[model samples]
Target: MRISRCVRWPAVVVAGALAATACGSFEGSTTSGSGSADNLTVSLQFTPRANYSLETDDAFVLSQVGCLETLVKYDAEAGALVPLLATEWVQTEPTAWDFTLRDGVKFQDGTDLTAAAVVASLQYLLQADAPPRAFTPKLITSVEALNDSTVRVRTPEPSALVPFRLASINTGILAPAAYTGTGIDPLSHCTGPYTPVAQTPAQSMTLEGNATYWGGNVPLKSVTARFIPEGATRATQVRTGESQIALGLPASTVPELEGDARIKVSSAFTPRTTGLYFNQSRAPFDNPDVRKAVQAAVDVESITSSVFGGQAHPAIGPFAPTEAWAPDSPPVNRNPDAARRLLTAAGYAPGQLKLTLLAYTERPEFADLAAVIQANLAEIGIDVSVQVSDYSAIEPSLLDGAYDLALLSRNHLTDIADPLGFLTADYSCGGGFNISQYCDPAIDAQLSAANTENDPQRRNAIYADVASQLQADAVTTFIAHEQTTAARLETIESFVDDPLARYAVTPDLTVSNS
Candidate 1:
């Protein structure tokens, strides 16, 4: 059974509550079935941001709890789009594609999952100011339900990779009741293996196996997921048996926990990049010389080794070495003298330029990276004042062009399967998430062409060129490419970190209490 309730509170209160709470035994599994262990408690790095139906930040959490489903799934290893809700699809027209969904699936609300429901979910996501922002809706022209199991999506132009966009959590298909006149209602109107029983925003959530779940019997009966931002605290929780699984463990603790017999650490290279976003719309930063100066000032080696405790790799480009398109280039060398010369050329003298550096504390490494960057820039005569806050608080200033520089950890695979979506959003003019406000007509034209190119090899070549141009322009200082590390108990069987940062606890997961 699914129960939906709204829990509204100030962000301050949520933070305080999390800080005060320690790991403790919660409710047990409610589902009646044979499994190794009955119930499980998991810890996450970020809480679900408010207005989930509209916001994209917490969709991964929603999907992990089995409360949401996307039309397709991208198999990163295979480099292909596999079926999820969408069983098969074919391009009916140059601008349109028709999808055949798996039938007999029902939402937690008992509503028959239909093609119209898919259209409604997609429509709500396309609306401006929606909670979970998506670039997919911008490319789409219209959606129509051809039959009970078939839905057709038409783009403004011919798009060969439309299915990839549908795989994003931002486009998760929800029941009609989930969307209200105001926006998306935070309810468990999803079609998945489990349904949400109770949800407390930024606090905790409870999910139970859907007995009528279309998928086979869920391994674990129930799951209670908590949002614990502090990595050390999460490490403590998993170590103390307060939680069986913990996500977003700090690198500093990995050594300590890896030696322990009770704990196991699982990590993988995520399509996530840590970088400095230079606000090109602002003064000093607007000048290419200044941008290059700042890029050259930082020592990425220290960031990857000292700051991350050697858990991360120095970024060669937007795509990490894990990605096939990552360029075979030498590491960026720190040249303080050249940086000073460029600053002088850009009409800035030593100690003359002062700028604000913005960052958030969601990922603890970012705050540390910001401090290192602050120190690195200071050596080159640039005065930088760092402000640390929640991501929600910092994002507005970034989008409004109020910030001079932003230390951010962005996922390249968040939107579409290819890196082009990430490049276009960060480098192209009029990009929805262009907080840096960097734009180049040549870069934009090349990326626009790459978006529709069907051939994978040809598309990769285009992306390689775009990466080169962005690197030469020094649009932003690429810091490190991150690998997601999680702390898990030894009892948990078949544990793996999803490269996409979703699907942590799937039907494959099992637990052995003995």
Candidate 2:
């Protein structure tokens, strides 16, 4: 799920929410089952970025998730990383290993999956200056084409997390064609269960199944995705039968849906978190007390019960017990009294400090939650201004530090079964999605040390220490690790979550109307 924030409030304030509703990159989707409808229409919270490229971020990649298999794909059902692309992998050394490609597989584009193509896709993703660049495949030092279906990937240093990085969305497999004509640009060519029909950013996307796909042919003849930002209206569409599958339904609407037997919600925890971001590089937040005051003002018990209802839990930390890198000692999540003392010592007066809270309006529940928070903060003597808008405006607001505070969310992959990949992305000084812009040399040193340590217990200890310090710094307020509420028609069977956030809907699974 690619959660995006809405932009609003212009220069005064910016409000945002975490809502991912588009499907363009491949994850295991639509398992072997019967079609609920000859044609299926699913509604996403946001429109796809584009349907034009076979690039990992493109819409088709959503359709082929977990199937094209590289090193591994998240299997929610089994709660582990399973193989799809490479049958299996072995560690040659700390920094080097060879992947023996799965044989007899063909791309949806009908091209064979060869060693050269694999090499190309791997290199393109790791080296490309695009979204996949966020994957930092550059951690890989070199690639060696061992044979027609074999390639050796080498890292400059001893690192066991190499293959795990390849399981991210940005690492979705690419077709040979996405390479040939594209001048070293791996963004074109395509691969997945369904071929891209067409896509218009901020509008909609349509897809068709590839009959010649090596995995198998799709059941539904067509899939059209509409981008609808209004949460209530989208929920109504599900109720009225205008939309068959509604992705990213607000938590508040879930209860009503649960009452409607006609609908079935298939939900799982996404490796994502909804939280309060602190600009550690700047003031008040730079003062531990101010950060704590904000934390104290947040009533997660109230937030969870009133706003989230029964849908979510008050988040104590980021990684669920499922993550390989989940800290054995999670950060201290609650310190309301300490928060008060910190604010008092920081010389802050109630209502004296007014800050902007940024969020998007697509998920109305979050907007409502912000209102609740605003009221709660007011009780604590902190004044907060609420700003809400479309996703377009919220991003720059984050980068420019236009608002004193912003409501943000992150969707990441546990591709390697550890915190190494996600922590690196979230903490790197100039990371791809380091919204907080947190730059701590000490933290970075710890992360780097963990990366090079091949010993499991020792590495986890290092990561745990990093997590502890961040907690002490109140670097960020950790909220609930959301368990998504997604509805699949009864005809939908094999859909499962890999706990790690990746899913697969391959064609090998049969779909019947029943």
Top TM-score prediction, candidate number: 1
Off by over 4 Å in 1: 1-36, 130-137
Q: State the C-alpha lDDT per candidate.
A: 0.75, 0.60
Clashes of each: 5, 49
* TM-score per candidate, chains pooled: 0.91, 0.82
Kindly list the per-residue Cα lDDT of model 2 for residues 325-394, writing each as its tens digit: 4565543444556666667799987667777788887656779878977886777677788899976568
**Where's the lowest-lDDT run of ten residues in candidate 1?**
8-17
- Per-residue lDDT value at 237 in model 1: 82
